[model samples]
Target: MTDFASEMRTLIEAIDTHNYNYYTLDRPVVSDAEYDKLYDRLVELEQTTGTTLPNSPTLRVGGELLKGFEPHRHLSRLWSLDKTRDKDGLNAWLTRVLKLVGDYNKNNPEQPLPHPTFVVELKFDGLTLNLTYDQGRLVQASTRGNGAVGEGILEQVKTIRSVPLEIPYKDGIIEVQGEGLMFLSVLDQYNQTAAEPLKNARNAAAGALRNLNPKTTAQRKLNAFFYNIGYSDNIRFDNHQEMVAFLKDNRFKVSPDTNYFDSIDDVMSQLEKIGSERLSYDFLIDGAVVKVADMRTREVLGYTDKFPRWAIAFKFEAEEVTTVLESVSWEVGRTGKITPVARVEPVDLAGVTVQNCTLNNIGDIERKNLKHALGSLVYIRRSNDVIPEILGKATEESDGEEIVCPTQCPACGTELEQRGAHLFCPNRLGCRPQMIGRITHFASRDAMDIDTFSVMTAEQLYQECGVRDPADLYKLTYDDLINLDRFGEKKANKLLAAFDKSKECDLSSFLFALGIPNTGKTTTRVLADHFGSLEKVMHASIEELISLHDVGGIVADSIYTFFRDPLMQDSIARMQAAGVQPRAEEKPAAAADESHPFFGKTIVLTGTLSAMSRDEAADRLEALGAKVTGSVSKKTDIVIAGESAGSKLAKAQSLGIRVIDDEQELLELLGLQQS
Candidate 1:
């Protein structure tokens, strides 16, 4: 009997190893027949001994149907994340976090918190799962019904091949949090043979996991990716990196796309990249989550009434839906380009009512076969949180009334000219929409940043004050604005003051306000920085412009042509004559001593400094030519540790790099005396 039990244990371990290799790693070393032989041997040995191990692979085939799910109280509460849809919202959240950290540091000088770093992970669009493990064996699995408790689905969760039935950590009880998902490919395969196809992958995974029959759940072939060890009795992680390492060591399948960053700017860039590649993944993701990397920082930030304050979900705005295209209309832009706007039946998408979608141009309309799509169901997607865009018709065979392209400008009745894929109105000086759009863009925040400016203001000035061009804005008199319907003496004076203040603007803002075709804020800034003066940028050739970073052939041509245009040149001359002094940004002076200790060193700053914030220290280091990074690796030359320094300091010490723990010494190195 002891021999049979021992053989059963060996066979169970072998089968579990094979299952992990086949499902989690996606690399099967044994043939299907060999795996079947091992599984059969384990079943036979268990029958002979009449005692099945708790973690045996044979148990994964599932048990008899459960009557109903039991309630489970979680060891620790699972917190949801605060969400932001745009960069502005994200910046606001970051501002609040920094302010909170600053407030906390001011109140608790003895235990000042470290600068908050971040870890970004994909926010999977599926059911949240919490698994309980005790004595190294999977004890219970449940959905995250509420933060406090949930319905136990242990039998159904056992069907997930990637989930570990037993972990190497056998000390005590722990609760792991993750998402249970159905891969897009798996959903496709299941739908191909199913009598009733699952409409969505997220709903399919949720419905399967919540099903009463474990056998039905097993048939769906679900998968899961563990992220957080929410509850641990015998383990503690100092940071997110340590927690992730622990999860990986115990055979939990974690996402490899998880990344770490020290600055919010880098995190925003990563979120943008992830949003761009959202559709490339095998699973569905609605957003990316940004969490404070340090566990102590998370604790300090703590939880709000509903979500964790330390973490925020940057949600992507693109959501596809089908709506009927009612009709098409033509609209003129600031550049005199005529675009087709499709009026669709109002549909709620991504929390907004989308009634209008862009058809790009005549060429796009023809290419997408949308010219005959009026009164037909079409697929529309809200991309980047701007206007919803019409992708195409819902069905390939769907067709309706042919959309007629206008031959004259809708705003000024000027005959249109075909330029590549677009139809342009040549009457740039007379078109009302074009003139108003240009003036409004000129006063935009990224441009001149004029106060009290709006499209209505532009229209009032155009109709009543004869301010047709942007340069005409400078010519407005007190009598001209105060005579308008809603303008008061105080409002007129404020507008005039804003105009005067906008004259002493930087070169980048002046260039961006020009509304040059195909050139945005980034391109204009690059031009201003590279050329350093308006005259040099205006005189630059196509070849010179093309050599700058991010400047393509079309953009270079637009810049060159815009500068050479007689109207644009005249406008610039008028603006300059109106006391507009566009100055180049002042460059920082070189460090006084090239041999400064911080110069040219790869430095890592950890923990909290009582004297100054981490950003200020990083800025000073950067000015002295030191590269201050987030993490400590072999390439790191020095580590400056302050109070409460954690894993990074330990790693630096273990690597035998130079360490500076004394605040007085650090101040001295930075060319300052301790206060």
Candidate 2:
């Protein structure tokens, strides 16, 4: 007997340690070959002994794919926390808690109660997952689908290397509750290869874990952090801090930023700190969770019909301000879509002088219960510090007239067409705004790389030289440029030279410059990669387009319809005649050595680089056969993070992705030593 059981135990422990290092720490001590050797040995021992650990790394290989998830009832119901956006709400709740405690003390005067303390943690904006472990061995995992009955996803749960399959505690059953989350970087990575791109991180996490294919879930790299103990047979704690300590001891990833507040003011201050630092977090946080620290106080407070009385979620308010609605204007986009923009009284918002905000559409106005009256106090919200929007009217009474949508196009005076909730101008040939928008887009940095071009210049050219579209810019002569105001001989020569230089732009940028509806930078790149030429992309059929990954029916139909337009085809032809032929899409570079760290990997660069400019680093990475991307995602294999790197750096750390220090390290990783 070769002590098969003992050997298996040792193997499992070694593999688990490696998994922790690689997956959680992003620091691998052993080579892949060595790790594989250990895994193979474990498999051999397990087969010889006819005993296998539930959390063994070999089980991650998984069995047959599940058809559908079966509904599994949770041992105890999971309740949602009551939410509030105001500090006063917390005060009121705390007052109620004190009243209950005061009554408890009154009944038992001899047993005087001390002051209550609160524990605060970040409330992650993600799906809730309940995990069950029997005798300290991982057994089942389910979603908080209705709080009572949830879909079982044990197979997918096992794919998350962070979740412990087996722990040291071997006494009783414990059900742990955690937030199932996907980092923004991971979601971006998944979208790079997935046929259907996910809308956001939260949705991606939910879809991945709910998927029947454990392989797909594993590839998504879903992560979880335990927050609460839903059901425990033998475990008992006097306070929440002790419970958190136990979870940390068991190697469960809990919130490292949890704080104990002695007073309500202190809790509110902590909430403020949490809200202020929200952008620095790797995962999405909608708010902060405030809970009574004492477990005895929680028991005394008990549960409401839906939420526990002892806990509350303090949601952060949207960055908003009240501004008087001066008027509304409609602007025509390149796609001929007419958008209603709100011209408001100049108010400072997010440190910017705000004037105009999007009204979206008639449906949006209706949904927001807006009267659209001029001079109405409108509530403008800047959510996530992005674009500001007219959330709704602050008051019902207005001093000015009701807003009227334009029946005719704002730019060309053509009759507008209504499609669902959107308004569009069909006069693509004559609309000035449409022409301006399209020409500006075509000359943008991501498009033709016409760095000196501007919308003002585009407008001037269209008005003075009869340059109606992008193709007309290529047709401009020295005389035409010299005739325009502020057009010096030097500027004119530079403009002409830039226009000529744009002909060599890659097929991807050329397609994006076309401004096709439902097409973005990523889609344009994928389309260019698939077709390899402009002609193929323009002539691609709807069915052919839809067959490609990430190209759904809507996008396919839009691209197909755009290419079929006789005007568009004629414009493309005109450009082709003017020596504006774009280069064919380049194939991914082949690496000389497969062992190169950056080879065949997608890398992102962020912040100010001391060794070189961001673009220079990107160029070097691409030269080494690595895909240099603008954003960080789960699909990103490496991030060359530099000084003062913000959210992307935080996200890379959160997902446990490798972050290179400088340009030299990046070059070294690519196996390109400094010459």
Candidate 3:
């Protein structure tokens, strides 16, 4: 062979190895710049030699846009699994499998099969992909069209870095089945700069794979996890475990969630555990798949008309559902931002009847193709137990009335102003909804911690007592609240006492209570710690505010603009006149001790801590130099799990992060108990 051909071959092999190490193993041996240099050199060599290897990594950049997909027949049928929604249904399926095995064993006592063990895998909520490999080279890729035939999308599939282009098993043809998915984190990143943000990760992946332009698919940054070897000419496995091992051995991206259980009950228990941590996953999963482990047992008990009898899918409660968009109503928030709340036709989703869904803003409405969606079916997703969100229209073609954006504020009829993606009412004082929302937020537990104060109290004070803002709350007298409905002498006095107590709150809580636009609890705390007092924060310039950690230009501008507003300045003056004293947070003595157990660690507290509120614990931990956060992540050093610790604890355990479930141990760390 010529030296040029040999060099090209060497580069191809090296690039492919790097791709396998980076994508499949997720342990890149070289930096991205180093890998790029290798890739660029190979591209240069290919261009000079006028030769591109079939399995070259450069093809992963994507080829010319395809006109349309072509149909490809599979060697083996990709059979679907029968689904069971509840434990009873799963138990019934298991009973049937055991009975079949027993009958077979009775008929052939001399050659009894081993008792069936089950393997459970996550049922990923993404597009099903079937890849065909001939002599270890990826020959074709397709969707699960009809079990036998599928639309070929080889070029699009190549763009997925996780999908192997070539394998070590070079004996003959092989076919593997996996799910194509866009990671939620990747989708969020794409949406940050995308002209029209993708609604959800699943659709982003499926749509990209089906798009005619391979470049579009590459832009989605898709990934896949191979779980099944559907067909193989020169390989055989005695069990599902062996098949999974073979796939992993050939540099396939396999999920670490695959587990084997000897008992059906254990499978159910594992499914429950998976369900708890489902939301914590970067990719979506609607359910779990339970299958017989033994290959011979699967063959003997498989092949129903539509599903594999040996395997069953245990589906969780649906998080996404279609509902009719009845009407759109704008609600003014504490910041005067007008949010479009859609009253959808009541639909059961994720175990609750969801009637209302958020459209986010006018931009979201238009971007999601929901502008003409009134009285039309829309897809609503309720994930992470928050309010359901309207993803997009159920169909591309709309047949309903247009969703008109309100020109005036729905609460006080003030002319609305358009800000980037949202509409806001400039009249912060006269807007009744805005006033009530602001006052209620100010008295919230996380804000001023005013006890006996509720939304009802805010509304009563707003309507009857003439309380227009947070400053107005400080001005309320015993007579002002006593005459209001449901506010007798005792309740009025209690409210007055709570308001008095709230006046002495720390600056962080005070800043948070002000309901500054774009500023959250963490930002308020950071501002308080940096500026030391409300006066300093109010006088801070945009540049000075931006210099603080976590405060961006937008937030700094918001703070500068808010404090300069004449109405806001008057409100602050009124609050000061009414004796609302916001004291600066006490600084920790010297620097935090480096030897402290929780010092300099990022900690997450989940569930109920009986010793103290999570907020109080977070404050104490912060005093000890620990950064307390809400969510569990790979960066988290410790997770303090209390009673009934749910998804966060489950996620921390799954990630192999350290977890402290004992309340006493946590108390010791907080210095509340004798060490």
**Position 614, candidate 1: lDDT:** 64
Candidate 2: segments with Cα more than 4 A from true spot: 1-5, 21-37, 43-52, 319-404, 408-675
Total colliding residue pairs, candidate 3 = 0
lDDT tens digits, residue span 16-55, model 3: 7888888778889999998889888888888898888887
- For all candidates, the clash counts are 0, 6, 0
**Whose lDDT is higher: candidate 2's or candidate 3's?**
3
Worst 10 residues of 2 by lDDT: 666-675
Expressed as tens digits, the lDDT of each residue in 250-285 for candidate 1 is 888899889999999999999999998987899888
Tell me the tens digit of each residue's lDDT in model 2 across 371-458: 5568788888755333567888887765556778889998899999998679999998899888899999999887888968999999
Model 3: colliding residue pairs: none
TM-score of each: 0.51, 0.52, 0.51
lDDT of 2 at 176: 91
| Model 3 misplaced stretches (Cα beyond 4 Å) | 320-675
Could you tell me how far off, in angstroms, the CA of residue 133 lies in candidate 1 after the best superposition?
A: 0.9
